[model samples]
Target: MSTSLGRGLACSALAIAAASTAPAEVPRVATDIAPVHGLAARVMDGLGTPDLVVTPGASPHEYAMRPSEARALQEADAVFWIGAELEPWLEESIGALATDARVVELLDVEGITTLEFREGATFEGHDHEHGDDAGHDHDHDAGDHPGHEDEAEGDHAHAEDDHADGDHGSDHAEGAAHVESQGDGAHADHAVDEDHDHAGHSHEGIDPHAWLDPGNAGIWLDVIAEELSALDPENAQTYRDNAAAGREEIAAAVADVEETLSAAGGVGFVVFHDAYHYFENRFGISAAGAISLSDASDPSPARIEEVQETIRDLGVACIYSEPQFSQSLVATVSDGTEARAAVIDPLGFELETGPGFYPALIRSIGESIAGCASS
Candidate 1:
């Protein structure tokens, strides 16, 4: 009887040892854009790679999902997105696919800060208020907000349709086959209805570009680790450890960017077709005025001349430009002034994608502004 009992205890010990050495399971994760992917990738660094939905060089505002992207959503255990405000197009598809996946809307992640869109070519007032959910309030509570049903609709609650991205129905029509498969009255069908309405909607709500802020990036890392942990408890500790490392990495980058931009001294004004205030606000710099008018629109010839005059008067260190607007016009505005036209991309379109991408993107913005301002 003593030997039998001893044998049983020995078998139990071996079983326990085997379980301890088994490989940990990680969730199959999917993320919306490069920055979000980079953050999520940090948490799942050794466990697995999170799939990115919005590939680089592609416009999130008016993107059409490919078949592989749809497959990634359908098979994913979790999906991370910036929320409807940034990729208003992906809403419906997420709802239709990614059915069982846990979707983490980073914008709605508790403690994440949001900024409202700055209107006009020249953001006149240059308001720096952080709204609950940017300028456009979305319930993401789907159904009634047929307006928010334009894009992907996987696992997100979706809320009210953000009229902010009015409609880019045409851009999705030619190649959105995967999206077109989402049943009879899917959002893709509605998008086709707004073929020419892209210019019709005024994008006044929240600026969904929250990832630009390294502080926000750090906040996102913790939440990402938490959610991924819940889905894959076996790797919870690894996820947490990765997040801690990511936060430290982000802190280090923020300090470096601060050091670089400490002397920028404001280039008098910033002309942004899209918004860069998240970066500006993070670094304690602000644009005095915009190159547009009261609303966020292209300036009339008179408005352009007025901006040029201001550039001349201030001898603005540099006049910034984005691809959304005309380069020729920017050159004309800087023609007689000492202000040099410098391009600053908010999307980090040129940066490599990976765990290090977010920090690199943040530093690049600081370098661009500081370099241009000083030169």
Candidate 2:
């Protein structure tokens, strides 16, 4: 070949090699909760870290989007959240703020099993939909405690303002009615009204804490991998491989948790809120009840008495508090009883934030329950 022709061939060959080895473009991701972020982070391992909107120790129910977080959502290539029910505050804002971002509501995703909110369970009676009721009074000073910065201290004041004028009440009632209609027709009307009277409450419907279940997390791992791979097909195999490996790690962690809990035996306990039904149901452990129905509202004196009575009646082993909220209520209830008070960070607030956080969070919960129950 002539010199110019050979030079052209050499340049083309070099270009082809460079193109083949080039790294895939990583997408900017935003997750609503820490646990979900942890799952997505695992799928995005070796790619990029997903930004977390709700910071550590913050309750999703009452979390306000900071300007930085709002920008993160707006700039994200994809935004992942549990659903409108879990973070009703984010329902309207996400549309406006992250208009161009692909919003993935994980609860709506397939292959994942969901648990319903149990009646009379911990934090079961309070309505999350009606905003904060002035009559319901439970002291929330625990949020101001050191190291618990993001607890829902002033959430009630802004709860009503969080949504558009027409977004909450009627829509919530309609959704609740839909849920009731799905049930047997006999109690549909009563159940619908009772359940959806408050737009944000989820007392009689699907529990949003699905990530508490390791099996559910495993399912989510696949979904996250699929979504990420779709966004960046060049690294599709890497995403799938990471998900597979993450699934194994989660499975092993879950197995270890199960064994530990088994050795500790079943311990009937009480949680600060009703967030752990998924975890409890998944592990076959039972919670006697919750301190409040929603973290933003305090349990009434009557409600506290009722829960204390349950603890006494059931001989519950432990009363578990969350890191995001004050343990005062747990302390008060356990004062006259033999039940031990313990802490469990459902959102992985106490653990390092990342892909490993989910498994660590799950393991910590099991360990806490086992410790309190066994002791």
Candidate 3:
């Protein structure tokens, strides 16, 4: 070979080696549940995948983290969770395993709307379409709490100001932002005072299932993208674009759901629990009753009777059960009754974890409720 050609070949080899090291390391993200994992995954699309701590079919209220889950946290560069109100079981694990990770308490994320848990055995006169003048009473300021969905009747707390503008990098700790209520909403003890139990931890506050509201999902996608971008700035544009695209997808999903439920204003239904309140509120529908409380404890005989009565009096078309919980309760309530029974998987237990999963989850919920209403 000629001397010049040999020198050029050596230079090309050195350039190739330098180019390989130019890309930044992808972040290791961890999430508390599948829904949140789906959101994080969207933000990190084409970058890396986030670890889901509590897999589908595993109750976040009572999950025993596997060794693999713990290891994921230990290796995580960042963590996303809805706060103790939803998954108190993961608190200690995160504290111990993901100490260095930037923890995002989504419940504390500002500008996100929230609602107080309804009180009572049955929603009865609390129908969203015909809701009486009865409103809500909340303690501990929720930064951006809106009044009764679109109306100005109810006064619930919403956490804002402290969590917006990409400011969710700090570790979530005590007094982060807790909600206390007198349970004086239109509906039982939905919002007990400052002390409640979820996996034997303090959980007196918001519904924690904010993901049900496609509006909140949009808010969360931006926050997820911001948090991921902060860690992986090299792909910041990709993260931002992914977040925007995710929001657009959610927007389309919301519009489709809104159209499906447009005429469903007064359609009454019973849920397995109160987890769907966010979804109900988003689409302007309300549950006639929930067979069990938000805690998923066995309902008292009186509560069951109340729910059954609600089903009968309102001519509730369908009773929805969740895949993660017992179907017997829904069956028991609707037995010998005309109400058709159905299932709505809140965590998208049947979904593949990815960018498309979040919108699909919301769409499934809308379809279930709308389908039941028409049935």
Candidate 4:
């Protein structure tokens, strides 16, 4: 070959080798809630931290996007949210704002176990058919209460129905195919149903509090790792390794919380709103009832009367308020009653925002409940 031809071949070979070893492009990711962002942060540990759309102290139920947040979404290569059921406002905006981004609704991701909103109910036992199937035997017998077994069974069945209606199979392809076969309106209508009403609050369908269950969080770690790895193929193993480590940590934290709350297992408590069902159920703690359905609204007089009656009738031990809402309602309900009042931060608003936030959030919940119930 001539000198010029040999030089051209050498340059081409160098280009090919460089292209072969180049690292995958890291996608800019945006996440909806703090806890969800916490999980994504773990998966993206060495890659990059995902931007959080909703800030601390803001309720996802009624968050309006700021201009900067909108810009973040527009710039994101991938957007991870729970689903329309959790943030209905995002239903239209995500498609319009983050049109170029790959939208992964963690709640719709296959292998994520979900729970339905318990209508007019408080935290019960961990008997619901979601999350890890490790059977927990509770000494707090609901059988002694009249009609408790029937009511509990009915609630469990409702939760199962909600899960089935969503058609969340273990196989991602099958689940996506099933969703597609249902037609476009199917998903929207299903979300409408799930977001429509809760406790006494007007909102969308099933309880979107799946993250409160550490088992669900463990599953989320895998899903997040898979999605991040797909986006950045060069860091696939790193993502998986982080997920494995994170999952082990979550499992350990969950076990520790369970053990700590075991002493308060049978103690009945009430909350400011109906958000902790997942946490309470996960640890086998039973709440008497909630003061209101949504933190954004005040309890109706009749509802207040009903909760007061529940507290009086059930002899509830504690009434817990959340950091995001007013404590006056909790005090009102607990006034003249023997119940002690305490606060629980379900969203980790008071904790530092990051990977540690999620585990701390769970630990805080367990400790608060145990403290109030044991007192």
Best by TM-score: 3
Worst 10 residues of 2 by lDDT: 155-164
Which model is ahead, 2 or 3, in terms of TM-score?
Answer: 3
* CA shift of 209, model 2, Å: 0.9
Provide the global lDDT of candidate 2 against the true structure: 0.67
Considering TM-score, which of the candidate structures 1 and 3 is the better prediction for this target? 3
Tens-digit per-residue lDDT, 1-375, candidate 1 = 699999999999999999999976678787887778888888787777778776565556655665556667766788889887666667777776677888878776554557776654454456565434445333444321111222211111001111111122333333443354443221221222211323223355666778876667776777677788777778888987887788777777788888888776566655644557787767777764455431124556776776776666666667777654457767777787777767776666677766777777777778888888888
Q: Score each candidate by Cα lDDT.
A: 0.64, 0.67, 0.68, 0.65
Ranking by lDDT: 3, 2, 4, 1
The Cα RMSD in angstroms, rounded to one decimal, for candidate 3 relative to the true structure is 9.8
Give the better candidate number (1 or 2) by TM-score: 2
Candidate 2 lDDT tens digits, 223-258: 667677777889988877777777777877778788
RMSD of each: 9.9, 14.5, 9.8, 12.3
lDDT per residue as tens, model 4, 128-187: 655423222222232221111211110100000001022222222222211232232212
lDDT of 3 by residue, 274-316 (tens): 7887787777777888877764367777888888887888888
Evaluation by lDDT, superior candidate among 3 and 4: 3
Q: Candidate 4: what lDDT?
A: 0.65
